[model samples]
Target: GAGVSQSPSNKVTEKGKDVELRCDPISGHTALYWYRQRLGQGLEFLIYFQGNSAPDKSGLPSDRFSAERTGESVSTLTIQRTQQEDSAVYLCASSPHGSLTDTQYFGPGTRLTVL
Candidate 1:
């Protein structure tokens, strides 16, 4: 495939609401990662999934944040009881081997706004 793709490019919701962000990685890529970027801040690793191995959930901020990837395809990030501070750009990236040394392709990101 050309590159990673994300859905619902932008979202607006009240505080305490839940939001689901979707990402489609490039075909054949085996590594998928989710990150969050708050305004004026850097990207924070959220979650990572590679192959059939168990996902690395250490990066998740809290129990409210979770993600799931099916094989090497699409992945979803779900935020429960969203807070205003959760407003930011959620980014997804994919690599061929899910290795730190591999080059990763990034998606456009989903801008989330919690009013």
Candidate 2:
């Protein structure tokens, strides 16, 4: 993908169902990240994968929220046993992270609405 791309931009589901969101980052980029934004709150970093290093999973709200990136390109986020509190926009970002304060490019995000 030229820029970060996310699929199924909007999702509505009954609570308790599982969901998976996909992300395709820009080519040649080396870092990928997932974030969750609830209502009016600022973006919360969920997981970050840089190169082959151990993924930084410091921000996932719970074990139910998990993400994976294959190599330096595509990634996916899965939310299990979804709850109403999980309703929000799931965003993915990637950047050329060799330098400090790299500019992260964002995707439009998948809006998950759990009823």
Candidate 3:
């Protein structure tokens, strides 16, 4: 079976530009997540989607950051008006279910650079 995957493994953009990062989770997985890791920092949760339930977006940093998922499949994270502080590796993960104890399989992050 396939694991989580992200596209455009590296992205370079200027400040004030908009970027969209894509992710594909394991088939049939009921839960998907988006995270961001700043240089030398731990991962920061950005969003979570589970089945048909409303997504948990509390971890999104600001209005500039948003994400969407279609029926537990592909997900996309959009960063508007990119900023230097937004430079980081964007990670995606998936679990069999949206449970606190479920193991999450991670995708190689899409490294974003904001100049």
Candidate 4:
């Protein structure tokens, strides 16, 4: 009955470097999400994955940001050519199902710092 979890709780990287953040959602959950929170800003939706359906990636900021998930398990968010503007808290969440009204359980987030 573990909650969602993210790895490397803190990441420090230089500009132009690439970083991969990992997430493990609750067992049996069929929906997973990735979000970003910038300084003094609200959470920004990055991507969403549900069951075997195609992922919703409309929220991704640019081509430099990408994510992947296999089945209903672990997910990874890769940021290529990191930028200073990319410094923020990357959050992961999961719900029982991919529904708009479902409650999402959040992880502690991986703080990414770009220098």
TM-score (C-alpha) between model 1 and the true structure: 0.96
What RMSD does model 4 have?
0.7
Off by over 4 Å in 4: none
| Rank ordering of all candidates by TM-score, starting from the highest | 4, 3, 1, 2
Query: Candidate 3's residue-wise lDDT over 49-109, tens digit each?
Result: 9999999999999999999898879999999999999999999999998898899999999
Which pairs in model 1 have colliding backbones? none
Q: Candidates ranked by lDDT, best first?
A: 4, 3, 1, 2
Task: Write the number of the candidate with greater lDDT, choosing between 2 and 3.
Answer: 3
TM-score quality measure for candidate 3: 0.97
Model 3 C-alpha lDDT versus the unseen true structure = 0.95
Whole-model lDDT for model 2 versus the true structure?
0.91
Candidate 4 lDDT, 71-103, residue by residue in tens: 899999999999999999999999999787899
Q: Give each model a TM-score.
A: 0.96, 0.94, 0.97, 0.97
Q: Please write out the lDDT profile of model 2 over residues 37-104, one tens digit for every residue.
A: 99999999899999999999999999998888888878999999999999999999889873588899
Query: Whose lDDT is greatest here?
Result: 4
Model 1 is weakest, by summed lDDT over 10 consecutive residues, at 96-105
Among all windows of 10 consecutive residues in model 2, the one with the lowest summed lDDT is 93-102
lDDT of each: 0.93, 0.91, 0.95, 0.97
